[model samples]
Target: MIYKVLASILLLLVIIGGWSWTEYQSARNTLAVPGEQVSIDIKKGDSFDNITHKLIAQNVNIKPFWFKVVAMQEKATTKIKIGEYVLKGGMTAPELLAVLVSGKQKQYSITFPEGWAFKEILQEIAKNSYIEHTLTDSTIDFSALMAKLKVEKNHPEGLFFPDTYFFEKNTTDIAILKRAYDKMQVVLNEEWGKKEANLPLKSPYEALILASIVEKETGAKVERPLIAGVFTRRLEIGMLLQTDPTVIYGMGDNYQGNITLKDLRTPTTYNTYTIKGLPPTPIALPGRDAIVATLHPAAGDSLYFVARGDGSGTHVFSASLKDHNAAVNTHQRKAN
Candidate 1:
């Protein structure tokens, strides 16, 4: 009877040991190592076996048969999303499963500087890795993209807000540009809400148009409000804006050298000399400060400005036509 009892006890121990080994193998196959960035792409309706092979090929360190079992246990078939994912090592089966199911990729940031035109911004995105397009498609006409965004004008000038934006890696250029347009809309709405009373601007769009002019006129931060004040004052007094930047923008790529008196009188919609009030659209993407400056300009009655040629970048302001003409001849028109 004692010998029989010993045999039964040995059999029970063997069963318990086998059970523990099975659990150990299950856990080992499901868990991953730490600090590794593993990328896996799961296609639509892909079977667990096929996905397992892909992970193994990518050095995921998980066995196919055991992974299927774990996936089944976790009910991951319907939960997995189709996209690229970064799975780290030392992650549990649940954690990796969650990543794949979420279908979220890493987000990257692109910064658009103040005063950049739409074409310039497009070129920047084409060269960015986070933004993708076929090499041939990179030069796609912007008019259609602008149309898709529903911008009123044929050109997308001043529609894209100059700011840093976050996007998924390999994001399309149009996608980033759409975000830029949305950003502009948001910012303009906010600024319009807090606008100062009695300004010459008729609407938020007009304010943006004015801000674009300010952006191209100068890079001086403190001077933005002053510059805005000068233009606003001119508009109120029924005087022509006569800004040089407008002339440059009108010239486009064909601008040779210095703008002559003839260019000032040229009949272009962008020419402040020819047009009344603000230009038909924005000349460039203005920064926040420029927008704010348009809403709340510096208190001044100065009507004219000329670059001092001191290279210090500060312009000399004048209230009289006589002073302005003298400064222009002294600083810019004379032979250097």
Candidate 2:
């Protein structure tokens, strides 16, 4: 009778050990088919049970009992962060738990291209569905918005850097704007310290104003320094900038894709054609290259430039009005 009892006890111990080994092996195996991907969102106040159910709902092939055991063993049962996470097919239970505790959420990106205006930046931000929209009105008061961003400047134009920014889901528009603004500040200051001597710009802001003009002037990469040279010389000689982009900006919504003589004659704060000096603020967001070109203008005697008008965006530079007129006539005649 004692031998039978002992045999039964040994059999029970063996069954328990086998079951434990199976569960441990399951924990180490992949939860989903190889190469499959799943996205899961863990919300605030979500319990471990809730997370398990969500994984199952997404066909993650996770066994709740073994998953909990693994989580307990890793001491990550309460460490899962609340955000969107991507689970790959080949991830084991331990690997998934590590990701949950790592707090490295999936990221989304938004890009602000070079030469974009403040309004254009606002429009692009509005189009992103993942970003949380705090400023509903595109025409919100600039002063209040700048204040909210902790920026001392009254105008927000040219303050934010033009670059691709990544953020987690539901990041606020203001938060991204602040990041861009801070980046621009750091970059502008660093570049300003290394600027060329004898520049007519009195402040970093003036360089920004000129840089914005350079950005809007041409799409040709090589022409930026040349354009900056012409503008800088014009400033040095007390000549009217007479640039068409400034006129278009001054005209605001009145511009119709073409600049007329009368439009150039009309004066506004931004109209370099009539204004004696740099505009009150930047007309658009200038990239780092534009800023650099403006600060370190190419050494040249050319005071005038016009588009070549032969399908190439290259411009013909002239040192005298006569040569400029000839180039303009030649290009205009071809265009006509």
Candidate 3:
């Protein structure tokens, strides 16, 4: 009788051990390989229970009770991150926990095109649902905004670098603007120190002004240096810039796409045709190439240019008005 009791106890212990091992393996195995991924947002101040609930709602259908038990055991609740996370199908219970605790939030991207005005940049930011919009084009006071950004500039045009910026959701538009602004300052200062000698520009800001004009003027990449050369030569000779883009910018809301001879005669702070030297500020955001071109213009005798009128978006260079007029007539006739 004693032997039989001992044998029974040993057998029971073996069965329990085998069951526990099986349960442990099952817990570790992939519960369900998600056929489709689902996004989950772990908001700030969310409790561990709330996170578990959110995971379930995101189609992470696993053994919720067991997953929770495992999470608590691993002390993952305290380390959960707050951000957007993607829950995939093939992840096991431990894998899901690892992902949640890893704090790998989803990131989104926004791009500001080269030559985009500060107003247009604001418009883009306001329309982006992911970015937190605390400012608007209509309400952004240049002085106040600059003060807040610690920038002592009178205006903010051409200050922000145009590029694709990535950030997690809920990031403010101001933050993005600040980053772009800082990037432009760094790039401008670095390139300004390497500028070519005898440039008409007196300061980095003046280079930015001309660079903005060059950015708008550059139809072909190769023409950038040539355009810069022409502008620089014109400035050296005290001739009106006569650039159409600056006139358009000056026209602002009144511009109807086409500029007439009358518009050229109209005067504004940004009207290069009517104003002498560089504009009071950059007319638009300039790219790195445009800035570099303005600072280091190619040496040439050409002082005037006209559209090639071959749909190639290229310009014809001329040193004299007679040559420029002849080329203009040829191209204008072709264009007409």
Candidate 4:
């Protein structure tokens, strides 16, 4: 009877060893087709069981028992991060556990293009469903927002650097705004230190205001310095900027698709035709090139420009109003 009991015990040990080896191999095998990918969200306070269920629901061919065993072996059960994670098809159970423990969450992007206004930036932020919206309204309280960002300027316009910003899911809008704002400050200060001497700008803020105008004036990268030169010369000579964009900005909600003679004659803080110097604040978010162009305006005698109106988006530069009017007559008449 003792000999028979010993043989049965040996048989049970062999079976258990075989099962353990099988599970170990399974833990190392791919969980899905080689090139397949899946996304899963692990919320805060989620249990290890909950994560296993989530994986299974996403069609990942993972054996929960083996997965848990591997997690225990790696000591990753208490270390998995909470965020959106992308799992690859060829990833083994151990590899997935490593990724979760690393906290390398999926990144999403939001872009603020050059020449966009503050209102447009706010609207874009509001439209992003992945971001955590913390602001009270689309028309943000500028002073309060600036305080939150720790920015000295009360106006938010032209403060944010226009570029593609990346963040993990559920990042706050204010967090993104602060990043952009800080980036702009760094870039502006750097450029200001390198700016050419004798420019009309008194401070980096003035450069920003002029840069915003240059950005709104043209989309052509090559024309930016030329446009800056015109504005700078005007500022030096006490000539009216007469920029239509400022007039339109002043018109605000009242501005239609086009500006009128009445609009130019009417006075507002932003209307360059009526105002003597730069606007009370920046009118739009200028790109790096615009800021650079404003600081280092091209050397030229030309003081005025009109669109070529040939759909090339180029302009005609002139030194005298007579010549500018002639070009305007030629181009504007042709366009009409």
Instruction: Report the lDDT of model 1 for residue 292.
Output: 92
Any residue pairs clashing in model 3, and if so which? Answer: 33-89, 34-89
lDDT of each: 0.81, 0.90, 0.87, 0.91
TM-score of each: 0.82, 0.96, 0.92, 0.96
Error of 2 at 223 (Å): 1.0
Best candidate per lDDT, number?
4
Which residue ranges in model 3 land beyond 4 Å of their true spot? 1-17, 31-33
What lDDT tens digits, residue by residue, belong to model 4 across residues 1-336? 999999999999999999998878877675642457888899998999999999889888778888888889899989999999988778888888888899999899999999999989998999999999999585578899999899899989889999999999999999999999989999999999999999989999999999999999999999999999999999999888889888888899999799888889999999998889899888899999999999989999999999999998889999999999999999989898
Better of 2 and 3 by TM-score: 2
- Residue pairs with backbone overlap in model 4: none
TM-score, prediction 3? 0.92
Q: lDDT by residue for model 1 over 1-336, one digit each (tens)?
A: 998999999999999989867965665455663456777767677776777787777777666656666677778867787666778777876677777778786557888999988778877887787577643355565576667667766778898899888776667777777888888899998998998899989999999999999998888999999999999999998899989888888889867878988999887988999988888889899988899999989987799998877777778898899998988898877635
List the candidate 1 regions with Cα displacement exceeding 4 Å: 1-36, 88-90, 128-147, 151-154, 169-172, 310-312, 325-336
- Per-prediction RMSD in angstroms? 3.9, 1.4, 2.2, 1.5
lDDT of 4 at 234: 96
Clashes of each: 5, 0, 2, 0
lDDT of 4 at 264: 92
Tens digits of lDDT, candidate 2, 257-280: 998888888889999888898888
